[model samples]
Target: MTPDDLADSELPMLSAAQATHLRALAAPHYREGHQYSLESLAHTCSRAPEEHWPDLVAAHFDRLRQASQGDESAEELLRGVHARLLPVDSVPSELLGSLRYARVVADGLVFAYALDGPTSVRLLTDRDVERAGLQALGEAARANLMRVPVRHEEVGVEGGARLRSVYGDSPFVAGQALFLAEVAWKVVGERLPDAGALVVVPTRHNLVYHPIADGSVVDAVNSLAAYALGAHEDGPGALSPRVYWWHRGSLTSLTVIDHETLTFSLQPPPHLLGLMKGLVHLDRAGRLATRAAAEPAGLEELMRGAAESMDRLVQDPATLADAFRSLVSLAHARCAYDPDVAHIDTWDAWATATRLGSALFTGAPAQECHLGEDLVWQLPAFPAEPPADARGWLDALYLAIVCRQTDRIGRLCRVPSETLRQDDSVDEYVLHWIDTLRAYFSDGPSMDDVVEKLVATIETSGRDGVTHAPTEFVNAIDYQPAALFHRLIARDHDTFAKALAEAVAEHGGYWDGSAAPRARVALGPLAMASLAYDYGFPVDPAQPCLPAHLLNRQRLEEFS
Candidate 1:
């Protein structure tokens, strides 16, 4: 530990290639201000008896030399080195009492087994590690072992390794987790008591732990992950974004945050999340059975309560509402300089706010609505236009529309008792808005012209007392006429013709002689003339707007 010892240390000498590789591997640690010397790193490598020292150093340096520029291959190469030299899991009876040790050697990794009889360290070879099936274990050990000194306080002992700290000074990277899990299994396994270990990751870097129940090793690990996610700090980077159940050398299960937005948007999966929340809440409330396993009766009752609450949350709509409200509030706070909607709660309030939220929050399309799932059942009637009432169904509907949730939009579209009202065409308006959104947001067409033509068509139809036909005609072809006409107005006749041809093809050839051969065959001339007039393009009188139909009729005559 002293400078004199460091100077006197007889460490492994590295070949030119090995030294270069070590330098490259050590670059990151050096950049982060870790000044590790070859001798120091060598000392840290698994200690071995004098006779085995040379081979161990050589193997350790060889491992370093094999690493690529970025050490991306560090794990694989290190594992190879260990597999070659370490005793396999199926070892001779004589070696049963020995213990294997893993350590980071400067930029490299090293392993050695201490013989029980002689109390001497025997360096492991690559072949030995492979035979032992200890590659994953080695990888885990090397990765999780802290390179930097962490401010740690040992909380407990599990298996052979000590529970060093509840939370680490920094966040666990993707691979360190594998090591932690491996170590946990090695040390804790099924011996973990009923009060599961509590692992709290306030940030990706820091993790805190306490015992909440007595359980097996795997259960304890699972509980730790669940608690980390449910109980961590709020907002991005403040909390662990996700947690995983690590066992058998890899992560088997992980529950992500933002279940609704990220997984199932229409409905969030509540069971696992509820279980997670239940445990964390129990910890927070001091209601857990004991610091370890709960007394049988008390633990059972508490668990029953947790289960009931989870089921109730799944069945109740209130949980959904609360989660959405929180997320919307967060979004609003994020947009502090220019928030579109004020925070509103309660079913009635959200109804009216849905409309305002849609209009004001029109920064970009969101993936999900802030309105809760309960809004669907308690939805009030929507007036012809979006009502001022926050409780009206249109409020939620508008928000869904603006958020660009097509599936939710479809669901909301069916929720209204009456699809239309006096002077207000609810379905038509929704369809129109969806088109406007797709066009504007996707950059498929000009928004100004699309809106202008749609407005003109609606106004013209209203003035002419042509109720529903214009809208129906527009919807039948899936909102392409306006876009086509916009092109036509720009004197892009070629594009218009090409688009029209493709549209007809998609709807089946116009003269198929079916009841609805063309999607809007009955209103072909009217729809064409309406678009032409709206955009200031003159309709060609001699041309048959229903070209396929005209051609088919002539073909029939010729056959006859």
Candidate 2:
């Protein structure tokens, strides 16, 4: 979707449909094998000649990243941006989960919009009673006469009159908590969509679902619901709702991750950090509990134990690693989808290695994912402060800890880019992860998954015996040009399906049986022996987490 398409869609801001089209248009530009540099991205997205725009992004994402790092005033500007950009339920995730902090003005606006029950659940607060439940949360919020207007019809009724609303402008962390919980609460109850490698977490930060009235109210006041939309923002203010200060460092931001690309202070307030941690624990517990309750008695027991195993982190390091790793992978998939993340920072290298990718292999049609609700609800105009879109701020944190494919997404997410933040070590782990996958795919037995696809790439080879890997290429893996076409550029179902069929036909039998690798393939371990050499994880039989099994077994029994 061209910017023109976006403008024509009458979307408040970037819609799901337009974004998908733009993604298709930009797909050909992501040539990792040719080492497509940032220098040429502009041509891929611009109407102007390649020489004119020079960069794909508008230079605003960087500015916002900078301002988020340097200026206190930028916090408010960031909030203002959220006010503009997140004007509706259109934010990449739930109302306010973790990407950024909020100021009073943004809070007020969010509350007013939410009071009408736009996209938000009730405003979370530690004070609300969990016993009150969703119904109660709604009732309490409704019963209290907020000075802000409710719906116009309700506003006119008796005692529906305005009262001095108590808007709590807490620390950045508090704002983050509210965002996560609101989003989480909403997600936990809904039938979430099947996002590829995506996790639609309703709760993030340390916020969890607490039943205590005060806890509930606090959750309400200081919570944000979240979703991880797959969007990229490397082109400066690509993260910005407003074009002017998008990445300008002057427009919006409370905190910026993906630290390496720009400068920023990573010092979150101690309380905020603690609060976030607490909320996260709560969220994990809730997920575990919910999953267990909804599941069969046996697995429920296991999940219960897993949830309770937080107590075992110090005593059971291996168990902790397994649990954490699982969580990390889930988070990584979502980070890929989050719109606010600088694409350059958040996308996996595999994502950039476009010479052999299937851009539309799994995506819905271009016409389906239209512009979002944000332009009206959230984003502001160019030069205007963008609504604070905290999806980047929060999700990137999870991406770092969970995806651990740090080298791939860290710089893109901005976490490693920060000179001030320590060696987050996120890359350290993710690199280890890539090696693990490489080894597993190489030396290990082939499963039913990628074998056929691998053979297809080889079979479909052109005269040079060079055919693209299903989602990657050989020579291109080493370097890439300014831009190259990938599969699925036609923006149609037939094209997507046909390319998938061809790729599958040629390579679909690599794992027809238990035979590991006759030769090198994308998921091959031999292709990544160096990776296995660097960091070790169990291969083949899948190593054991003995303690996890024992403790988790016990915990599940209790729940059962």
C-alpha lDDT of candidate 2 relative to the true structure: 0.24
Number of the top TM-score candidate: 1
Q: Pairing residues by index, what is the TM-score of model 1? A: 0.21
Candidate 1 clashes: the total is 41
Native-referenced Cα lDDT, model 1:
0.34
Q: How close is candidate 2 to the true structure, as a TM-score?
A: 0.18
- Candidate 1 per-residue lDDT, tens place, 338-360, comes to 12222232222223233333322
Estimate, for each residue in 18-114, the C-alpha lDDT of model 2 and write its tens digit.
Answer: 4354444444544342211221233244444433332434342233223322122322222222111222333434324432332223211232211
Candidate 1: worst 10 consecutive residues by lDDT?
Answer: 551-560
Displacement of residue 210 (Cα, Å) in model 2 is 15
Q: Which stretches of candidate 2 lie over 4 Å from their true place?
A: 1-83, 86-237, 240-268, 276-560
**Each candidate: what lDDT?**
0.34, 0.24
